[model samples]
Target: MPYRHTIGSRTYRFDDLKTLLARASPLRSGDVLAGVAAATYEERVAAQFALAEVPLRAFLNEALVPYEEDEVTRLIIDMHDATAFASVSHFTVGQLRDWLLSEAADAEALQALAPGLTPEMVAAVSKLMRNQELIGVARRCEVVTRFRNTLGLRGRLATRLQPNHPTDDPRGIAASLVDGLLYGSGDAVIGINPATDNPKAVSNLLHMLDAVREQYAIPTQTCVLCHVTTALQLIEQKTPVDLTFQSIAGTEAANASFGISLSVLQEAWEATLALNRGTVGQDVMYFETGQGSALSANAHHGLDQQTCEARAYAVARRFRPLLVNSVVGFIGPEYLYDGKQIIRAALEDHFCGKVLGLPMGVDVCYTNHAEADQDDMDTLLTLLGVAGCNFIMGIPGADDIMLNYQSTSFHDALYVRQVLGLRPAPEFEAWLQQQGIFDEHGLLPASTSSQLLKQLPPALR
Candidate 1:
């Protein structure tokens, strides 16, 4: 079947639901690179108009990637809760958008609607929304989860203190970890993207982070972003694994490229839960995703990148992760192209993830070679803060020497916290106050004494 819409004197026809969605999407370099974007602005608008009339139920029938061919599509289809979708099932994509933006789509309503929604539905609705609309609907959907600390609470923002080292140096990693903590940045997790994936090296990093957490009694989780299989091995070795981390994609093929499958993720989730490591909650999985991953892996199956990105969220949703973030701009300019494109994709990823009920965060970053600067990051970070994002990456100085990208820094986290009046995770915030690093008002004191110093070892001090 075909979808068509007329504006003025012209009628634009989209060959299929997938083509209609691709055409309806806002302009992005990745879509263009994949040869899926609309040929002209008018065609794009026409597709949006046609898409607006699409019934929500249509997505249930039209599998962009056939159910027989893709496990992700199967997961999406088999796991959908029709009862949860009843509220908006009869509405067109446009009507769904209207309902989401209306006053009735409160936090409670959105949560109830999450299980019923497929990732494609949310992605379709997102295409019809502007940045502000995206922000508005997302802020209303509060998806909280926990491991060592509570995250996604209203008026609270968390940071993943990425103390990445160029050579997996324990000393260098420790210095950056202490620095991030002193700057009040590790409420989400003190995560490291290690330079080496050696099982022993990764296990050592995990133990080192555990030792620091034990020594200082920090109220947070720790993750060494390595392969799921590596974490599984570490778990068998009795390593301190607070969270099992993986970079997941939206499709089975894309996930296979990362050496993961739904079964593999299920195994990791079960293995991590067996440790009973969390003091607060058992959501121990941490996932990172990005746009264009499926296309990059040659696994997109002709779907647009944004839709593929949303499908990845379905994978994350299956696990009930402690943290699920889109490293939006880290894929470099080939996908997002420039600051404007990066900003748009970040908002879209955050919005789609939140609506589908994930504890979503963003790595607000760009490559050095990309057409973006710190100012672009500042704009995105501030906007995400305003939109009530669950967490962000907190590098040392907005630069990841190891990852070679410019992400938001520890200071950047503080700036957003100060400007937006957001606080860290409650448990971590109390710990900060207890250490005298943060005062009663949650502001850093003008003067520092040996109080905080006493909490650290001599080397860190």
Candidate 2:
């Protein structure tokens, strides 16, 4: 039997609760109350309430009475939108006191409602409720300190392990490290390749997902951009995948064809949506084109900035409602460092603040050879940040060609710390010195090796 949980005399089954909450319109009080009452277990109640579209604290405030302080605190912390709770009138002192002092309230009931709630949780919720931004200086200091320790060759080599292939055992090692580095620091997002050619890769990704779900409990989604074969395979298998879509290669011929035919883009969009609907609850992500590495290459292939943006806008305009409000993903220029303008044009013209009518996220490719240089990384980071991208994606190893020959271990760690605001360890100094990046003067190099950078495509250079 599935684990169950209860809240306010209502019991629910876990799976049922998940399905109910996953529904698009989950805020109706009658629906919630009925689901809660029909629930057969406590976890069901918890999941239903936990995954509700409305904030958990707000729901609890409106639905329950004779509340426990600790339960209210936990609900606030568990709420995805704790910011919404402050305006809720039920949390006022009078209401709280009334709920606390009411004869219907029992000490045991309060304890059960918010089991193991801590003072720290209460303080977090309280601060969030008050609309106070937590001081970010301490967090920044932590990242810098960590970076200082990881500045040496020994540190670099420690992270240079290459997995033979994407499989459960090897991928778990990667996922654990990545998850540890990224948890709670919202600067980076992970994407898994669900290519049909390699079932092991998909299996490995599932293993990674399990680890992520079990350990960090992150709520972020994944997007699969693959060919038709992989898309159909995943759909046929009835996998509860998140988003699946196609990857279009950018050549002059394809670009011209795309320009001439709205039907082509429309058909692709309709087909993806149809697949998604058939797959139960998965979403579809659209990409404008793949790999615009050279000006001449793009021009020769009919995929200049104008054409690229035009195609993106065509798709964005057609599916504005779905693309704008939905969780969508787009890839930026791959194999082309100078393609930032193309990226910017696409965003400004089709994606930026309008076509999607929502915050559109652009995924940055790790193909730039200068990824190791702090200056280069910083420039890209600043560009993406300014471009209003929601997240960045890259592989985890240096040897991965897909990552543009970048060292995944060092660069990935550094990028996460710099952009995501994760806390650093004081002992990281000893760790970095062990890696030998520091000279006798304790100063690290300002840039990566030119030889390494030379290996990158000229467009990326």
Candidate 3:
């Protein structure tokens, strides 16, 4: 049945739950490109007005993507914690929003409420929220995961030391890795986006990272972002794999386009676990998601991009991933046209992921073609800091040479840490102190007297 709302003499109707969601979403070029956006501003407001009245229970009853057609939908439906949801079962989407921002929805309550919520419900409430509302609610939702180090603890922000090399050169990667570590980054993980998927190349890069990690005893995880199948093959070959990495999407079909399924992910998760790599904790999966992946793959099944992005979190939560980051602006101008859009999407993605009980992070980034720059990144980085985001990318200088996009850098991480008084993961923080990179207060030591630079090998320097 269609849902309708009225303003004066005008009545707006949404054909279905999916249509309602699409029309309710904050305007984005991707939604417009999908031809699912509200035709007019008035219609968008009407949709939001109508959506606010939707009963939270209605999402449970109505399937946005048919149950028979999508495994992701099945996973979401079958795994929902109805008992946890009973607290807010009677509330409308708008009421839920009010409750979320209310003093009653503290950290403990939000944590307990996570498993009960569905991606659709979370996405719907998000559509009704302003950016600050998104941040405030997300701040209260603390999601901690462990793998070599604890993450998502309040008063801390982690950094993924992304030492991506265009040619998979070990020395070049090592230089960048050392640079990031010296800057007090890499507490989250030392993840690499390799230029080649060649099993040999992937194995070599993993070994290089492992060698350095072992040599320095860096208290963090490392990942070579390759296909799950390649990771499985490497695992079978006894290659050192710290975190099994994959780029996931919201829909089963979109994941299928990436040659992955829920089963494949389970296989990879199990394979990585059997290695017993982590010393601090066993949570050992890393996932990267973005707003427009499903739509870009032509497998969105008519849902809006942000909702699709939230659905990917459903998948991430299943495996209990240590790190689930949205590469927010990496998809380019088509999905997020400018800095403002990218910032909004980043906040939304973080808020949605945290609400669903995932340790969420953002790759504060943009392609060169997009209408964004470092100033935009500075704004987003500072906001996410205040929002209590789990982590951000630490590229060499807020630029990924291999991927050819701008992301948060090692220096950028320091800037945020200094300004916001955020620290790295506890384990990595101790390591920084031990290495004389950071003083007792977790601030970097003076460059002249710093031992961190001296620790770097002559070749790396």
- Per-residue CA lDDT of model 2 for 237-345, tens digit only, reads 6543444444332232343433423334445455556644322122244343332321223332222222222223223333321222111112222323333332332
Against the true structure, candidate 1 reaches a TM-score of: 0.98
> TM-score for model 3?
0.98
Q: Which residue segments of model 1 deviate by more than 4 Å?
A: 446-449, 455-461
186-298, model 3: which lDDT tens digit per residue? 98899999899999999988888887888788889899999999999999999999999999998999999999999999999999999998887899999999999999999
Task: Give the local distance difference test score of model 1.
Answer: 0.92
Assess every candidate by TM-score: 0.98, 0.38, 0.98
* Winner on TM-score (1 vs 2): 1
User: Which regions in candidate 2 have their CA more than 4 angstroms from the true location?
Assistant: 1-189, 194-196, 199-217, 249-283, 286-303, 316-359, 365-374, 394-402, 405-461
Worst 10 residues of 3 by lDDT: 448-457
Residue 361 Cα positional deviation in candidate 1, in Å, after optimal superposition: 0.3
Off by over 4 Å in 3: 445-461
What CA root-mean-square deviation does each model show from the true structure?
Answer: 1.2, 20.8, 1.4
In candidate 3, residue 302 scores what lDDT? 95
